[model samples]
Target: MLLVVNIGNSNIRFGVFEGDECVNSWVMNTKPYKTEDELYSQFKIAFKNYDIDINRIKDIAVGSVVPHLTYPVRKSLQRLHNIKTTLVSKNTPTELTFMSPQMGTDLYANAYYAFKKYEGTKIVVDFGTALTLTCVDKNGEIKGVVIAPGVITSLKSLIGSTAQLSDIEMRTPKQTLGKDTEECMQSGVIFGFLSMVEGLIDRINKELKEETYVIATGGTGHIFAPLTSKIKIYDRLHTIKGLRELYITQKKEGLQ
Candidate 1:
């Protein structure tokens, strides 16, 4: 089994792939102070819950967006699997063109997977800590990336910053015209993002002079996926799957 870890700003996602099939996955809230033992315990608990032995995991692949938690995660994986843990980056073999060093590793995973898995000009919308819009042409050349405030990040910022406004459920209100404060916040956050997504896609299409395949992937992807007209695919597992594919390719090339 291949263990894939996508360490994001908000959460750490773990996926266990048996051959081509991802049989198990877990999401852990990110905490910088989390010890290696704590990390191992989390993995062990997930393994036990799924009846997957720790020893069965042959290798590890890490797609990290957080730098502070990188060594800790790799160390934990090393202690558990006692095997190689590959760090995925732009350097990893992939179809998408990488030009910026500031590009997130998660974006690389999404871009490569979209170009190889879906095949063609693609726009990947990631609704995570930061909403990331990445465009890749049919020839596997990356067009650009647009970054904006993520759904939950925006929510946290609003709730944390405001004096009167409190946290509300992160769900779309039944109507765009909210009735109460809760409904109003939900409407603003949810519907506002929906509009932003579609509007941006339209602008991107105009710039590209062509339509592109759109895929949304993230913890909150399902929320915006149905509401947005541009998104055709919603798969939360996209990042981990890309990590798995990257590992396989890198291993073949003896980069691991």
Candidate 2:
């Protein structure tokens, strides 16, 4: 079995995969001050909770945007088990020739998974901490990318700094023109983000000069995908699935 972990800006999502199937999954809040022992303790507890044998995890593949947690995660996994642990990056198994040097590993994983998981020209829009839109051809090369403020980030930016507004549920309000403050905020966030998605997809298609298969992911993607016809696929596990693929690819390439 393979233990795949993707560390995002807000959450740390981990999955236990039996071959290609993800049998168990869990999410942990990303805390910068965590020690390696504390990190490994959670893994042991999760295995116990899910009835997943700790001995079954033969490989640990990680895709992390949090730099501070990277070493801790790897070290903790190493300390807990003698299995191989890897950091999936463009410089590793996944190829991102066109991506900028500063591009996050999670984006590369999403692109690599989309390239192999689907056929023909594909564009993946990951609605994580940042709304990342990536285009990759059939051969697994990135064509372009667009990064924008994410749903929660935008909300926090609007409310976190301002004193007038409070947090609102991520749901489409009864009407676009809301009658109250909460309703108005919900409408603005849900509908406004939808507009951004549609506009981006349109521009991406125009730039590519061809229609591409669209995939939207992340925990919040479900709220937006149904509202817009632009997203043809919605699989939240895209990154971890790609992580598993990258693990196999790295072994196949004989990377030590």
Candidate 1, residue 110: the lDDT equals 82
lDDT (Cα, tens digit) per residue for candidate 1, span 1-256 = 7889999888999898888898888888896558888988887777788888888888889988778889988998898788868887778876557678788888888888887888668999999999999988877788899999999889999999989999888887999888999999999999999899999999999998988899999989998898866899999998888777777778888886
Candidate 1, residue 60: Cα displacement in angstroms equals 1.2
Per-residue lDDT of model 2, residues 135-156, tens digit only: 8988777888889999988999
**Could you tell me how far off, in angstroms, the CA of residue 127 lies in candidate 1 after the best superposition?**
0.5
- By summed lDDT, the worst window of 10 consecutive residues in model 2 runs over 90-99
Error of 1 at 85 (Å): 1.4
Give per-residue lDDT, candidate 2, residue 187.
90
TM-score of model number 1: 0.96
